[model samples]
Target: MAETIVVDPITRIEGHLRIEAVLDNGVIRQASSSGTMVRGIEIILRGRDPRDAWAFAQRICGVCTLVHGIASVRSVEDALHYPIPANAQLIRNLMIAAQFVHDHVMHFYHLHALDWVDVVSALRADPQKTSELAQSLSSYPQSSPGYFKDVQAKLSRFVASGQLGIFANGYWGNPLYKLPPEANLMAVAHYLDALAWQREVVRLHTVFGGKNPHPNFVVGGTPSAISVGPSSQASNSGTALNMNGLAIVQDVIRKMQAFVEQVYLPDTLAIAGYYKDWFKKGEGVGNFLTYGEFPSEGKSIDDLSSLMIPRGIIVDRDLTKVQEVDLRAPEQIQEFVSHSWYDYSTGKNAGLHPFQGQTNLHYTGPKPPYEHLDSEQSYSWLKSPRWKNKVMEVGPLARVLMMYATGNKPARELVGMALSKLDLPTEALFSTMGRTAARTLESKLIVDEMQAWYDQLMANIRAGELETFNEALWEPSSWPAEATGVGFTEAPRGALAHWIVIKNGVIDNYQAVVPSTWNAGPRDTLGQDGPYEAALRGTELADPKQPLEILRTIHSFDPCLACAVHVTDPNGEELLQINVT
Candidate 1:
């Protein structure tokens, strides 16, 4: 007999996620992932200006703030064949790169670190030993014994109050956590350091986009104009894109690169030295997908060759040949609702492409506040997004593998180095720890290339190329009666795209296939489990109650259910619908 272990509302993630793992003989026999909420940004976009969609769509998830704007604006641009200025493309690249570095660091340290590091165990670590461990790893500035002592003292206070604060609700004494006390203390200290590091680095977004966390964006290009003058537009507010802002942006990139090299990358490798078993677990559908991201300045988006990260499909762990991906092909990508809480006109078993995508809400799963979700039927709010009718994993692992398969020298060197350091084979890249390690590897690769992008921008400014926005397709009079487009970006989590149907200058239909929807969605019509479910299969539990092993694998993908799936009551009644004027 198998017993189902339900972990409702998986903590430290972006949105509502419930994991139901059926355990037999202390091993996971089957797993079903459920996104407990749904979002209607697609429905809200209908009948609105396509240009204004980014404003509403950007609110899809605060953590993935500027990405939606990038995808939305690009979808409209793709539809209209709109071309932006070279400098605008450079700025967008820089901003997107920053988002990746920032989001990845935050996810690893804050959201996923506790799964490995025990804060309660950190209190028992000797400060001197911790300082030595940190020094052996990287030349990070905060590795002094006194610094570790102070951090431990601070952590002690959190425990002393019978409240661990952010470190609360953790299975602190779980046997699955293998990191020694010294390593745990080192990780805890760096976790605090990353918190401060992120605070200053996000100013890069403010410098380029005029604000962080849902930065202002324009359809044609960036919103800010390059102003060398002191009295430029918004100069009084310090939001002007002037020499001062440019200098700050430069400094931010340098600081970001330094942190990744010194703290984030080394920390991951050091902590990973203890948990080698994880490299064998959490391997889900060997097939991977990527939209390919980070284009060069002045390069057209149509030129896939210009992308630093090559986009392609790796089917069944075959790294020898990378398959080409076409977003416009209707048969290549489609969404199914067979096991999700939505409906299609063609019926529950049919799949619909984004151009013909619909967002008709329907709930057939057990009502909320219930014990178990009947996985035999609709069990999740997320629609299963499949590429060529095949399940694929997305995110850092896919992107890294894409880069490696495409023969990117830097990625290859980094991947080889990480493998050598871990004493693991290439096959290990498919595991739970592999997904987490790929993130750090790609972050360093992207940051290493950031200097050139900054230098090019400075050269462009010197050459008097100051335009950011293009006005060719700015007005409705210049637009066609009907047009359709797709915009994509390799978001921090994975490949994210927004599709739009523009009619008479207004959005007629819209669909967004977020990364989480591809990963966290329930089973498809073929009865194949999503990445979350597939990864959980075969994972054994030490203590069924604690289930720390489950958290380790799931957190590797860094679930963002808020962006993946929705909103509504279980009774089929709209609880709240505010019409935005």
Candidate 2:
């Protein structure tokens, strides 16, 4: 008989997720991914002003807050045929790039690093050796022996106090952890450093958007104004993004670039060197997709001609040919809820495009705190998103592979350098470890490009082209009676697209196909597993009781279930409740 293992509320991720795996002789025979909450945010969007969608959508996930806002406003703009000024585009690029750097670093150090680093092991590490290891990795000035000793003492005190806090409930001392003591110490110290660094980097978002988390976004342009004069509205009011504020933004960008180069990149490579075997495992679906983001000059929202990140599909693990993604075609993208806790008006078995998508709850799994999920029944709240009805992996790996396959110069050079350092081939870029490293490389790529964007914006402003907002299509009278458009961008997690249908200036229907939805959705109507389930299949477990190996693969995609799904109950009553031992 095959045994079932359950990992509910996978700790440290943004939101709740339950993974059920069937093990046959210590190997995963099958896996199921479930989002235990319902995301009715789309329902909340109905009948609202199309321009206000960004505010509500941005609440989808606090961790990836700004991404939804960006996509939401872009959707409205696309629908209205509105075009923002060039400076607005560059500012948006800077904001999105800042998010990638901030979010990826946090995911690596705070969320995913613990999966590989044993906190207890760091206690046994010598502070001097830890400093030496850190110094060898990068020129990040915090690699002193005293710094490591201080971090170790803090860890020691936390352990002695018996309150591990965030460090609690981890699978410590698990045989699966491969990092040596010194490496563990170095990672832990940088983990703390990242906490401080993130605070400074997020100031970039505040300068542009007026605040962090859900930043303000207008359909035509950003809410920020350019101010060069002392009596300018922004200068007098001391609002962010003023002339003085622009200097601060430049400083933040410099800090972001420094940290990515010094700490994030080196740390990822150093730690990954210990678990190189992981480069061969956790390959899923063998299909990658990216909607393509970071537009350069001459790139329109609907076209991929000048996108810094190319948009295409690589299927069956073949990187030789890239397929073009057509979001407007009815048959191109569809969502299936066959294994999900929802019903479609047409039928549960039918696949619906975003313009015609529906969300109706119909939970049909074992009650909460149940021992195991019935894999044959509805299991998740996430709808399986398919491109041409094929399971696809997205996120950093997809972007990296797309750039590599297209012979992108910078991507090729960076990937080549990293692979040569690890003594691995291009094939190694297909696994779990590769996904994590790709995220690091992506941060560098985005940050390096930030300088050019900033320079362009400054030049445009100096040349008397300070326009940011485009009011040509701001009036409701300017739009057609009925219009539909899709806003697509590459979020930090992966490909994200939001579809909106507007009638009489009100949102008729809205559907967001988030990155996590692509990666963590349940099995589709055709019985094909999603990326999460596909990656879990055939994974070997060193200890069934402590499934660290399972987490390594799942977290590599940086699962954000909150962005994938969300919820509450009616009439002040809990739908289902259970106590687990």
Q: How accurate is candidate 1 locally (lDDT)?
A: 0.90
- Candidate 2, residue 467: the lDDT equals 77
List clashing residue pairs in candidate 2: 38-566
Error of 1 at 55 (Å): 0.4
Per-model TM-score on C-alpha atoms: 0.97, 0.97
Query: How much lDDT does each candidate structure score?
Result: 0.90, 0.88
Tens digit of per-residue lDDT, candidate 1, span 1-581: 78989888788999888999999999999999999866888888999988899999999998987999999999999999999888888899888999999999999999999999988999989999999889988888899999999999999999899989889899988888889999999999989999999999899889888788998999898987888666455486455588888999889999998899999999999888898888999998999999988887657666789999888999999999999889989999999999877678789899999999988755444544546888998788899999998998999999999999989999999999999999999999999999999999999999887888888888998899889999888998999999999999999999999999999989998999999999999999999999999999999999999999889899999899889975454365753232222
- Across 78-113, the per-residue lDDT of candidate 2 in tens digits comes to 887888888888899889989998999999999999
